[model samples]
Target chain A: MAAIPEALAELVSDMESISDRNERAELLIETADRFGDFRVPASIASKPYPEDHRVKACESDAYVWAVDRPDGTLDFYFDVLNPQGLSAMAMSTILAETLNGQPLDSVAAVNSEIVFKLFGKDLSMGKGAGLMGIISVVQTEAKKRLAAR
Target chain B: MSVSITERGYVNPGVLVSTDWVAEHQQDANVRIIESNEDPLLYSAGHIAGAVQVDWTRDLNDQLRRDYLNKASFEALMSRIGVTHDTTIVLYGDKNNWWATYAFWVFQLFGHTNAKVMDGGRAKWEKEGRPLTREIPAYAPTAYTAPERDDASIRAFRDQVLKHVEAGGPLVDVRSPAEYTGEKLHMPEYPQEGAIRGGHIPGAKSVPWARAVNTEDGTFKPAEELKQIYEQEQGLDPNSELIAYCRIGERSSHTWFVLTYLLGFKNVKNYDGSWTEWGNLVGVPIEK
Candidate 1:
């Protein structure tokens, strides 16, 4: 597993500590709203199929891109193009917050099941948690960048 | 030759309306624009000026249960959201209106028929460069009463789906092809929402939810095309009792929308408790 970046460690704890199922859902919604506030243009956000970056596993046309920081860290930014997919957006925020400032080596090794470990099996996620599965994609992206370096 | 996307040959032309039509009626007291997206926060980013957000996982869902809100709760939601009996609800959202259609299906579950989908949903509107706002509406709540959800008409349970299969009824697997065939349903990290066994119901047909809608603008195809695919290609009779399903009920709701509303099928139901239930059942029949 990759090392948890200090910035996102707090968010991970915050999301994990939410006891109320409904409030947990709300937190995801809030995180998604924050993402929307960034207002990433459609040209950038809309990644159609076969772009390779698209999160096709889930129903939404979501995409994730990781940029290498000058300090050799990875910054994660994602867009779950579906407006209703707050849970997916929250999943991206989790990765962004957790890995954004982490070293490339650690980011590449980040575990995709971090949520399963964090939330445990309490998430009554239906049809698998498509958005949460995105950690693997982000980690892979980070690993590719690391290899390029 | 293709027909106009806006004008479809159907008995209920009211099922789908254009973004321009929605724009013209934004201020109509009788109409309410509800933005129901796959991503929860899209409404906050900048939704249609007068539109309100419907949280499928919150408002429409039973917070404590896997099912939807009970009738009383649904009625209360309708009231709180300022929806009345006659209010013309126009639903729109991202993912080519998947959740929008799911929301519409839920509304139908409660016998709310005044609702229609905004053609192309959030995608089409945004593509057309329509105005979007961050104004969270604070409309005056109104009197909205809904009957108990009529499950028998527009919804399907596991037992019914099983029997429907036994009778060789028309069933549409609206999931992606990989899912319909029961392959690649999960990952090493995430436990995918799939049945223990893969494949589909014995007599089911794979329609692939995306086929019903045009991918470019995220709008549904013309009525004739839809008819051709579901009827001519898939061999579904308009008079038969059709059922649509996916991993969850979400994607199938889009297909249900195509059959029930667009094509004017007399009896169509969305198996909201779709693949998850069918896949998990102990003794149900499956087809690879």
Candidate 2:
């Protein structure tokens, strides 16, 4: 059996044990990866899948890129799932900027470099986390640029 | 400690600064602009002068919750971004600023006082007619301040949720019809197993988080609109003790903001453990 990464192993374990009628069907995917073929109760199996932009961002590689609309003032998102990583990244970027007194743009670049290294692989492209990682770097850099002027 | 770039980046909410703000401050060289265009590689192809990409879920999510928001690993994350503490942050994103709001909440929890969410995010700024450039910007490094951990502001743990359940409190599941119905659950671990052997908490309700926002661009709906949605759709009362949860707590956080911030509900609490914890509990009773 392929071992789940330590970081993600606990997540895999927890997914297999969910007892929610509605959640079981969904956990089946995770279970199959870790546990094995199992019957999803007919009640949960029969339900329709949820339709959410974030879920789409997680499951597919269709990166709906967006540029600033019309005037091009700020950035635009292709879908509702664009800003998922914004706050988490911003918190640290802001702290780094304040603590080190380093220029925000520089920090943004550092972050970008890091994100690029982590998720830049072809297979990882366009996932929610991948896209968000990049956004954190860009947004941090953007803040640096804006603050200086 | 080594930290991933995503973990260390800033956690400010999305804000749409006008072109004038960008222009007037263009020469300042301190403000950084991030494109956050949903696609990092795409942003590399062409972005606002110096903008980079930011990951939404992975970077901003509460890793501890893995599915909720009770705790966050912010300090370890900051070191990776080279931010210590005391940084002023401006954040923005397109599509009504859902990502922006998420960031705003995170920063607030971490006690980053200087952070602000761009009003209207990218959509409003663009509509107002602002100039944009594809030139990448450069800059030096800066220091940042670490925030105080305040669990009260951001999350509620499993015990808290259990207490609420024990008290016969009502919980609001903020996922969509498919998610709530278990047809479209996000976490892959539970294969069709409802967290509880049955389904939802005995008296829980489904109030899709999207209902709190205007579908047009992802911005939250007006207070009146939210009130209407809660009353008509989920039977929520401002005076009741309410706990909101989603796959984890992002959507529920948005709902929390709306309920507490917009609707001015005093007794609302966010069930950070949400379905992820509740559904997985061993002996908890569930309803279908």
TM-score, cand. 1: 0.82
What tens digits encode model 1's per-residue C-alpha lDDT throughout A110-149? 6566665444344335323665557668778877876787
**For every model shown, what is its TM-score relative to the native structure?**
0.82, 0.53
Report the lDDT tens digits of candidate 2 across residue range A1-149: 22322323343345335545224323322222321112123333322433321223332211221122233223312222223233222222222222233333333333322322222222122243433443443354446455656
> What's the C-alpha lDDT at position B63 in model 1?
71
lDDT of 1 at A8: 59
Best by DockQ: 1
Pick out the ten consecutive residues of candidate 1 chain A with the lowest summed lDDT.
Answer: A119-128
lDDT of each: 0.76, 0.48
Task: After superposing candidate 1 on the true structure, give the runs of residues whose Cα lies further than 4 Å from its correct spot.
Answer: A1-3, A15-101, A113-130, A141-149, B1-6, B187-192
